[model samples]
Target: MAPVSHAADRVQSLDVYLNACKIGTIVRTPGDFNAFSLDPAYRATGGTPVLSLSLRAATGGLRRDPRPLAGALPAFFANLLPEEKLREAMEKHHAASVRPGNDFDLLAALGADLPGAVRVVPTEGARAVASAQAPQPPRLRFSLAGVQMKLSVMKNTGKGGGLTLPLEDGQGQYIAKFPSLTFPGVAENEYANLALAAALGMDVPARELVDKADFEGIPEEFDTLSDGKVLLVKRFDRGQGGRRRHIEDFAQVFGLYPSRKYDGAAYHDIAAALTMAVSPAAALDFVRRLALCAVTGNGDMHLKNWSLIYPEGDGPPALSPIYDMLSTVPYLPADGMALTLGGERSFKALTPSRWKAFANRARLPEPAVLAAVAATAARVNAEWWHLPERAAIPAAVLARIDRHITLMLPILAECGAG
Candidate 1:
């Protein structure tokens, strides 16, 4: 009974830690702005409101204790680096020790790397760059190039806390992410994968890893040698100069329609959400790309991981920047695409028969769909090996990845042209 009781308490503590890891704005003081709280369903654990972030700028060091949520969360993230590497990174880049005490000084420290979209004004009305506007709490704040941003907590929502801030300088907005302690390598992995995708000519958000000590919203403990780092990417949705509308996830745009569930309506709604007329041709193209992703070993393609972005002015919405792109299947044994194809769970479902069936159901020309599949396969075969090598992945792992890619090419070729 005593052991059980202890375990229960431990779980509760992890929950609190996980909840605190989410991304949100830090108000200088509580009640400075309206309190916006998400419902319980938004969290990984469906108990209390996992995230209670304030939207307004707050003062102090911008800190929150994670001890409370330590139990419900895992001690480490799935498929990250070994524990030792994480420990070394945390020690080398302790955020607390490097941060300035005030926002103005922090902004001065961040000099030129700041994005052009955000502008940081002085508390007394003097316009500073972004770092000067950081909300001070128990967290450490710093500037990068002059943009004001924080790394306070990871939002409980699985959306990964990527945002496009409006800065005054250039049109480029920032994309921020707060990873959990459980996933120590998430920041580095995301950075690496983003680079990989870009090199492959896939559209991805411009991204980089900010030193934890340089951001005011991140807590000192989180930036400590023992704590993990967060990953931040630059947003592309912003207009030429920072004047852009807010971005929306597919679920929000599609209403109650479930993306993981394949149906005629699902296909139609997806095309409509992109503001493109539904057609068998487009569906085949979309599915072929997705199948290519699977062949390349990306198994984390859930609905929320994809989005449709509307840029400034009138134009049909296109696929949002490719994100959350990873070879999850190779790293995490349990990882797989969230949606099934032809009643099969793995990428193997991209069989000729299944592809034909899906194409027929979507009212697409089977030949076009098959051609798309062949193109994707050819692209994978031609470029896959060169990528891992240039990325400096270990030779052994690269070999395994090549084998997997090779295995999928035959199946993709088998999909007959309509």
Candidate 2:
């Protein structure tokens, strides 16, 4: 993969790496178009495909030609960078990286120290990861797309257990989320909902809902109320001792930007992508999670919330540990499922026929599809109902959940019929 030369440090190419080994190069053509090609040696090494199914051909390698992306970074490289306010913050911190109408330069700025093993180094000198020079609190607008206000943080060792503070530039070990003024009891709401998903046997990350008083150096706006709760979630993409493992959300996998994250992809497309890119077991896991999302009345499983994880050395990717698992039914009472399933987005209308269509669309074996559906339905019936109340979820929010349960009964009924 030889890089073409350009005039006066225009940054036309970037070297791509998986861990320590160089894998490929991404280039910005004369017209600000993004194109990519893998190292011929890298493909021969029995290493897993770096980009996703959309970019790489079905035979498991990048297409013979370099191609421009339809959305953000080449499907594999997009989510490695931050989004929304985090994007704004990173841009403000590294002013040189932001050139109007140039996407590749912005990528070059955020490429160093990305989420997973994949690193993007500019044709120039090594780039510093985008972050504040020192650890800073939630001073910059902390709001992201979600209703709840959240920030990237590290587990604070100074106060010992049950304390976390802002993490900047360096690898963040956790994500700190606070209650919502619009949605009351969201901390407890998300906590109880995540617990339900865990009971159904998902690889959920570590999370705890703590009293607001336990944290220090945080802006009071984090929790909205002085006595509210704060949710501290361990970063699944970061391993022991802050090592960065490779991870990419469905948004990045499909080459969609954050603005298009919700509308750009559908659940059927996600399932199809998983079947081609990952193992049979990993594909089955995706089916199971989709089933759980339907029964739980979670209408917010957008592209950003779904992700894939790659193991250390050479290994095929698998669905990452589930994060952002919360039931939005209580808050967005009028909303339906975030992404469409089998040509429809309504949970109530996802009949067995549609599910079978989804299975066929995903190219999944009928037996595996049936098994995943059965497992999810049985688990929800056995373990879901009592969770929120037992978790001591607030009464008003619990009532909304109860109402959502009544509304979502059709999905459970369909599963029970099978």
Candidate 3:
């Protein structure tokens, strides 16, 4: 392995260490913030409480943490230390001898002491490991959180690479997402978008940006090493009242009920999942989401990016909230969406007739769905400018985003009319 870069070395030094012995044990009553006994032999080393970690179950057969060293810093960092003090410490610890291009062995070094079942392989040029199947030491570990809980990391394949993990905290579940490199002034764009969506009464997952350093015993990967930053988001699998449910991507949902498949064919469009809900009301909710995505200029919307949660019960399935909602048009160099809209990839091809046809094929009530779409578009347009101001996005970037939104506004308006 190449020498660890100054930035990676600093991150490694501050990463939290997880006690493998606690892999399948429940943390007893919280005591001393960080000191929680997962088992007699294993315990989490931290001065702050654990909000959550993403792990997978042994039975499900998912790859354990494919990149174990890429842990997010604990949220307690900001609360525990002053910003200037933390920055100074980081600067002092930065590895001055290491070069920028050196491949840092973060996961390998960190996982050396971990159990055999978990692997942490380091990627030569990338910040994160690709997969265990790749010709490298396993960089990630999928370990049981408790007897009944598991955790695993999910990467954001967006232009800005980020990390997210599904954490099952006893009967409660939440997703934790990390921050990624962005333009200097757009630091808090994700947080602002989430807050604004919440204000619009969207059922979004609970999210917060936290400092990783405050938490004691957290892995170094989670903290801000060098110039990189991280954020954490709670999973939506577990709901209030101790409800535990299975999370299925749109593809999985469609595959489960073949009868509801579109025209006896696999429904690859995410909109199909929203339209297939048994309740008309739920279908209408999806229409609102589609309009919101368009109005917000989230052009990267695709089937894989969305999911449907099937709670363990007889309740009807509902649409997951609008996530990955950054202004993709401005951020990405692509001219079209990841998935074709209205059977075409060209934005000009997304005509009102095509949308109406889509609604009809999805079995959605035209009037109700159109009304919801119009309402959501109006709300997003009205609130679009507020997000940049609140997030402190640079005026130049904000103007660029505004221009893209303006160009797409007419198309969004047409979708609402269908």
Best candidate according to TM-score:
2
C-alpha TM-score for every candidate: 0.51, 0.78, 0.52
Where does model 1 exceed 4 Å of error?
1-172, 176-196, 208-217, 220-232, 239-241, 256-285, 388-400, 416-418
lDDT for each residue of candidate 1 in 231-334, tens digit (9 for 90 to 100) = 66655545443354323334333332232223313432353334332234445546655765667677656544555554344344456677666555445644
Please provide, for model 3 over 232-315, each residue's C-alpha lDDT reduced to its tens digit, 9 standing for 90 to 100: 445565445534344434423333221222232222245555554435566666666666655555655554345555434445
Residues 102-143 of candidate 2 have per-residue lDDT tens digits of 446556655555656666777554333334444333222111
Worst 10 residues of 1 by lDDT: 73-82
Model 3 residue 341 CA deviation in Å: 1.8
lDDT, candidate 1, equals: 0.41
Ten contiguous residues minimizing lDDT sum, candidate 3: 25-34
State model 2's lDDT. 0.67
- Output the better candidate (1/2) by TM-score: 2
Q: List where candidate 2 sits over 4 angstroms from the true fold.
A: 1-14, 25-55, 64-75, 89-109, 121-149, 159-169, 212-227, 365-371, 388-392
